[model samples]
Target: MLRASLLASVAATPFFITAATAQDYFDIGEIIVSGGLSPIEANAFGRASNVITAQEIERRGLTTVQDALRALPGVSVNGSSNSFTQVRIRGGESGHTLILIDGVEAAGGDGEYVLSGLQTANIERIEVLRGPQSVYYGSNASTGVINIITRKGAIGDTYTATLEVGAATTATAFVSRRTERGGVALSFSHLDDRGYDQSGDGGEKDGLERTTINLSGDYLLTDDWKVGFTLRGSDEEADTDPSPFGATDADSYVVDDPDEFSTRDERTASIYTEYEMMGGRLTHRLSFNKTKYKSTYSSGLPVTRESEAVKYRLSYGLDGRTVADTDHLLSLLVENKKDSSDDNPLYAREATSVALEYRGSFANGLDVQAGARFDDNTVFEDATTWNVGLSYQIPDTGVRLHASAGVGVVNPSYFELYADAYGYSGNPNLTPERNESFDIGAEFAILDGRGSFDVTYFNETLIDEITDVATGPGAFSFVNQAGKSDRQGVEVSGNIQATDALNLRLAYTYLDAKNPDGSVEIRRPRHELALGATLDTFGGRGSVSGDIRHVSGNYDSQFWQWPAPTVELPSYTTVNVAAQYELSDTITLNGRITNLFDDDAVDAWGFASRGRAAYVGISAKF
Candidate 1:
C-alpha cells in the first residue's frame, strides 16, 4: 500500500507555509446547525461534523460545489469531469448520502438529480453531518447528510455581480432587499466549459453548460409568526464520451462518439411557516417541498433514454425547551413524501415517518441526546431507527470527548426495482438495506483557540442489501443479500494558526471497506489526505490560500461489459491555489490555478482530469 509514506509527506508541507506576520482571525463562532434538530454550539455536540461558509468559498476560489465538497471529510466524487456524476460519503454508495437544499430532500427517481447543477450562487453555508442520520432525514441517509443553506436577504439593500473567463466562462449576480417585516433575495449564475476530452484515446472536448437561478423570501406576519419560501431551477447540457467495450454492440457508452450528448432540467420549490406558542417556550414549523427533474441522453445510433421524476414532501415539526427549564430540549417531526413518474410503476411510491428527539445539558458539563423514528414505505415493510449521543467537557480546558451511534435504512430505488434492460428484470419483493453505525471521538484546542485537533473512529455494517441474482436461464433479477458490506476507519483532522494571519489545516482518513465476499469496495480510497493553508499577503490588502489532496488507489469493475472483474484503480494527487486583491472600495480582483501539478490523472477510472489551468475574475458592488 502506497499510503504511509505518501500521506506523511503531504501532511508535513502545510507547516512551511506559515507566515511571519501576525494578524487577526475572522470570528464566526463555534456553532453548527445540522448536528442537531436545532442549532447547537460545536463544543457541546457529541458528534463529528464540518462546516463550510460562503466566505471561505470566496477566499479559496472554489468554482463549483463539487470542488468544495472534495475537501471535506469522507467525501468522494465520480464523473462530472465531462458529464453529470455521483458523490458518496465514506465508502457508501451515492444513494447513501442524503442531500438537502434548504432542509428539503432533492434526490429523485432514476435520473440526474440536481447534485451536478447547483451553482453555489446564493449559498450562505453548507453543513456536513457524517454518520447515519436516518432518524432525522429518513430515506437515503444511511451514511451521511449534506445540508445546504442559502442566503436570505440582508437587513439592507445589496447587489453584487461578477464575470470570469478561462477554460470555463462564468457569470454570477445577486440582489437583495429587506425591511423590518420582510426580506427577499435573488441570485443567478451560468457556467460554460469546453472541458477536456473524454474518449479513451482523446479526440473531442466534451463541453458542458449550465445555468442556475435561486430566489428566497421571508416575511414576519406578526410578533411571533414568520413565513418563508425558497425556489431554485437549473438547466444543463453536455457533450459525449464512450463506454469501455471498445466499439462493440455491448457498448452503451458509444465510445468517442461526439454525436452523443445529454440534457437535463431541474426545479426545487419549498415554503415554510414558523409560529411560537406557549409563552415563547414552544415553537412549530410546517413546510412543503417539491422537486421536478427530467433528463435525456442520445447517441448517434437509434439509442436514447429519457427519464423524469416529480417528488413532493410535507413536514411539520415542534420544538420546545420547557420540559426541564432551558437546559432540556425536545423535538418532534412528521413527514410525508411521494415520488411519481409516468411509465415507471416503481417510481410511484410513498412514505411517511415520525421522529422524536430529546437533549439535555447537566450542570457538570455533560450533554446527552437521543432520538427515534418510525418509517412506513409503500413498497417495503415498516422499519424503526434510533440514535444516541453523549458529550463531556473537562472543566476550564478546551478538551471534550464524545460518542454517538445510530441505525439507518434505505428503500430501493425506482430503477433498481422496475428497470428492465440488458437481460435484467426488476424484483418487486426487494427490501430496504439496513445499517448500524457507531462512532467515538475527542476534540481539543490549545494556543488560545488558535489550534484544534480531532480524532474519530467509525464503523458500519449493512444488512439486506439489494443486488442482482440469476432468476432463470439467461435472466437476472434484484434480490436481497443477507450481508452486503462493512466499512470501518479512523479520521484525523486538525487546524493550527501558526501566525495571526496564517493558518494551516489537515485531514486524513484511513478506510477499510469490504464487500460481502471479502473484496474491497470500488472507488473508495483506502487512504485519503488533505492539506491546506491560508495566509495574509500583499500588504494585508490581498490574501492567498492553497490546498492539496492525495488519494490511494482502490478497486473497481466495469459492469455490463465482457470480462467484468474487479480491477485496480490508480491513485493520484492534485493541488489548487487562489489569490484575492481588493482593487477599490467597490471592486475586487481574484485569480486561481487548479491542478497545479497538471497531474491529468484519470478520474475514478473513467474520464481524464483537468490539467493545470488558471482564471482571473473581477467582482463589483454598489
Candidate 2:
C-alpha cells in the first residue's frame, strides 16, 4: 500500500514540472498582516511559529490549508480525502489546536475542531504558532494556535477567478472581488475518482463536493474607527465505501455509487468593531459570532446530528513605545453551545471564559508575554489556564533564544461526556483533563532573514486523563485514569534562500510518547521528515517545485497484537509538483500532479490512499 501511494505521487510530478510559468513576482513578506503583529514580528517574538501567506499558497499550488501545512515540521496532518482532513501539532490531539477564522473561534457542539469552514480562497494568511498558547487564545489552544486572517479590501475594485481540473475528475472554481469598500469570495470544488486497490480488486474510492461563500465588508466610520462583518457558509458531501477490509465480497467492496455516503453543512457569521486612537496606539474590538454544524452518516442509525454555537468577545489594546515598545491587551468572552442528536444524552453545554494578557518588547531586543484564563462550564466546576513566555535576540547576530511554560484544561467534549451515538454511552462524571507543558528553543537567521534555522525541545504532562476504556455491557465510557501521560519531542525546521532562483525548506520531528499503561497514544508518529524547494527560471517566468514527506512506522495499540504482533503501519513518502505560466497580466495557467510516486498508504484498518493524479488550472483577474 505504501509503495503504491509513493509511486502514484512520483508519477504525477512530471506534468507539474514541465510547464512554463510567468515572472510576475510578488513577496508575501510585504503584505500587511495584523493578528496584532506582522508574521515576521510574530515569528521573532514567539517561541515557535510558522507563517503561510497567500502568496505562499499560490507559489506552492496548494488547494487546501491542510495540504499547505503537511510540509511543515512537527505538524501532523491526515485526511481520508480533501473534506475529512485533521491536523495535530507536536503530539497533541487534533482537538487541542484551536482554529480561529478572522478572530472568531470555529468550534462545533461536539467539540470537533471545524477547519472545514475556512476557504483558502478568502484567506489572506495563516499563522501557526506552536506550544501551549491558551494564555493568549484560551481553551482549546493547549498545543498551538492556527489563526487565519481573511483578506481585506485595499486595492481598487478588482475580481479574481480560478478554474482547475485534475485526476479523480476533480474540478474547482473560485471567484473573488475586492473594492475600496468591501470584498466577497466564492468557491466550488469537487473530486471523484476510481481508486487503486491493493488486493487486486476492491481497492478504495471516494467522491466529494465542497462549496464555500464568504462576504466581508468594512465602512471606515471616519478613518480612525471601522466596523466590519464576515459571513461564510459551506456545504460538503462525500460517498465512499467503508475501508475494503470491512467487505467480505469483492462486489460489495467497491463503493457502488459515489454519492451515497455522508453529508455535512456548516455556516458562520461574525461582526467586529474596531476603533483606533492616539496615533494608532490604542485599539479596541468587539465581536459576536454564531456557527451551526450538521452532519449525516449514511451507514449509521439515528443517521444525523446538528450542533450550534454562539460566542461573543470584547478586546482592548494599548501600545506604547517609551523605554521599550509594549502592548497590553484584555479580553472577555462568553460561549453558549447546544447539540441535538438523534440520540439526545449529549444534548447541551454552556461555557463562559475570561482572559487577560500583556506583552512588550524591551530595549535590548527582548520580548515578554503572559496571560491567564478562567473558565466556568456548566459541566465542570471550574478550570483555569495560564502561560508566560520570553524571547531575546543576541546582539550583533540574528540569533534568538526562547522559552515558555503553560498549564491548561480541556473540558471533556460532548462525545466523551454525554454521547448516546450508536450503542455507546457517555460519562457525565468526566472531569476536565489537566495539562502542563514547557518548551525551550532558539532561532538563527543568516543572510538577512532569508535563511533561518529553528529548533525546540518540549515536554507535556497530562493528569487525570480521560479515556474511553471498555467497562462492561459492550459499551465504552469515559473514565478518569489515575496515571499521567507524558510526551517529549524535538522539532527542527528551516528555509534557505540559496539564491534568487532557488529556495529550500526542510523540517524533521522526533517524538517520545508513553503512559503508565505502557500504551503509545493512537496515531502519533515517532519521527517525521519533510523536504521542499522551488526553482524559478525563464527570467522568473517559469518555475519548478516539489516536496517529499516521510513518516515512521507506528503502533496501533498497547495490546491486541496476536497474529503478526501489532500490525505495523509501514513508513511512506509522497511527492507533489506544480508548474505555472503567465497567460497575460490578468490570467495565468498552472499544472499540478499529486502522489507522483503513486504511494498507496493504508489508513486505519480497511482504507487505502489514492494513487497518482494530475491536474490543470487557470487563474484570472479583472
Candidate 3:
C-alpha cells in the first residue's frame, strides 16, 4: 500500500485522463429512502442507515450504484472494472449484502450481485438498510439489504434524458418517456479504458458495453383491479485485463486465448396483478418472474442458468386511527434455479425456499416486526430461520428508540455445495451456518430539527461456519467447520445545519470483529469513518460538498501466508468536491472534482485508485 507521505510526490502526476463534458454524479431517491422506510422512518429506529436521494445521486454525477455506495461508511468497494464490484459491509463477506430490484431478489453469478452489470438510468430510488434482515428476505442476508425501486409511468407524458463522458472515453446516454398507458426506457453505456494496467488477466486495454431495455404496461381490468407485466434484458461484454497483483483485477491471471475473454446476456420477464378495496387501504399483490443467462469464457468454458420465482402478498390497515395506524403483512415465495456447463455437470444445483411473516404497530407509537423462512436444497437437509424487532418514539423530545433480536440460517450456494471436480471435492456433510443477534439504537433531533444524531450497537454470534481446505497449490475443497465467530460493533452518525445554506453529514463505525479462536477475520476492518458536508448558497441554485473517509489497516485474504503475514492497508482519507449552477429553469450546469487531494491510494497490493478527475454536465427538462 502507498504511504501517506509518498502521496504528495505521486499527486504531481495524473494516473489517467480523458476528455469529459457534463454528467451526473448522483441518482435520485429510491426504495430505501422511499416507502415506509424514509429518512424519517429510519431516524425513528435509530439504525445506522444513510439515505442518499435520487436528486442527491444525480447532483454528484455518479455512474452507478456501486460508485455511490463507495462514499458511505462501513462500505469498502474493491474492483477495477464496473462489471465486477465487491462491497464489504460491516466486515461481512462480499456476498453478505442482499440486493433487491423492486423488492425482488436479484441473484448474482460467481458473486457479482452486490453491484455489477447494472446501470442507474431506470432506478427511481434506492434504500440501504444496515444489519441482518433474514427475517424478511432469507439467506445471504447477513450484513444488510439494498432495495432498488424502478420508475413507473404516470398519467401524463414525461420525458428525461442524460449524457455523460469521462476518462477512458467512457460515455453514457439514456432516454425515457412515460406515457399515459405505458412506458419504455432504453439506455446504452460503454466504457473503454486504457485501464490502470493491462486488460482482464492479459496486458491489454479493457472495454465493456451494456445495453438495457425495459418495457411495461398496465391495463385496468376494472376500477378496483389492474394487471401489468414488464420485460427486461441486458447484454454485456468485457475483456480480460489483469491488475498488477494476482487474481485481484477483472482480467487477472490472463488466460491463453484473449479473444475468449468474457461475455454475458440475460433476459427477465415478470407478470403481476393488484387488487384494492376500501379506497386502496387493503391490497393483494402477486407476481411471477423468470430469468435466463448465458455466458462464454476464454478458458473454453460455457455456462447457462435459469431461475424462476413466484411471490404473493397481502396487506391491510387498522380499522381505526386510535390504534396507531396498525398494519399487517404476509408473504410467500418459491424459487427454482439450475446451472449447466458442457464441461462440468456436477456443478449444477436445484434450490427451493418458502417463508411467512407478521408485522404491525401498536397505539403507543411502538412498532414490531417478525418473520420465519425455510429453505430446502437438493443437496442437503432443509433449514429454517427467524427474527423480531420493536421500536418506540418520544414525540416531545423527538427521540426514538429501537431494539431487535433474531436467529438466521443460511444454505450453501451452488458453487459452494456441489462442485467436486478440478482437484477438489464438495463436502456433502456441510451444515448451514446459524447466527443470533441483538441490537439497540436511538436517534435524536437537535437545534430546532436542523441537527441530528444517530447511533446503534449490535452483537452477533455465528456457528458452524463454512470453510475451504486447500488440497493443492491451485485447488481447494469445501467443508463445514466446527467453529464459531463473534462480532460486536457500534455505529454513530451526526449532521448539523451549521447555517441556513450549509449542512454537514458524518458517520463512524467501530467493530470488534474476530473468530472464537481469537484470529481476526481476513479483509474486515475494525474501524471505519466518513465525514462530509454540503454548502448551498444563492437560494439553492448553487452548492459545494466534500467528504473524507478513513479505514483502519486490514488483511486482504483468509490464508495467513502472504508476502507479509498481515497486509496493513493503512488509514487514508480522500476528498471529493462539487459545485452546481442553475442557468435557467430548463438548463443547469454541474461540475465535480473527485480525489481533490490526488491521493495515489492503493487498497489492494498492486491496484491503485484513479486520482484528480473531473466532469462537467448539463441537465434539462422539457
lDDT of each: 0.72, 0.62, 0.58
Model 1 / residue 608 / CA error / Å = 1.8
- Model 2 stretches with alpha carbons more than 4 Å out: 1-40, 80-83, 114-119, 168-200, 243-260, 277-281, 301-346, 420-424, 557-565
Candidate 2, 1-622: lDDT as tens digits: 1132221211111011000010122333422122222112443354667778766777777777777777777777765443456787877778878776665566554455534323466456777777777655556777777877655433444456677776544454545444433344444544444334422244344556667666665555655566667776667666645433355433334344444466677676777665545644444555566666667655443333444444444444454521112244444445554444444543666666666656565678877767677776776657788877788989988888988888866667667777675556889888777779888999889788789898999898877788877767777778888998888899998999989899999999898877757667656778888999988867887677888888875544312222223445677788989888777777888888888998865433334566788888888766
For residues 327-400, could you state the per-residue lDDT of candidate 1 as single tens digits? Answer: 67677777787776544743577778888887777889999878899888887677899988889998888888
lDDT of model number 2: 0.62
Top candidate when judged by TM-score against the true structure? 1
Tell me which of candidates 1 and 3 scores higher on lDDT. Answer: 1
Candidate 3 lDDT score at position 274:
65
Cα lDDT for residue 30, candidate 2: 25
Query: Please, what is the TM-score per model?
Result: 0.89, 0.84, 0.82
RMSD of each: 8.2, 8.5, 9.8
The residue ranges of model 3 lying beyond 4 angstroms of the native Cα positions read: 1-48, 80-83, 108-110, 114-118, 153-155, 168-194, 198-207, 217-219, 243-266, 277-282, 293-300, 316-352, 470-476, 558-564
Point out the higher-scoring one by lDDT: 1 or 2: 1
Enumerate residue pairs that collide in model 1: 23-500, 23-501, 242-255
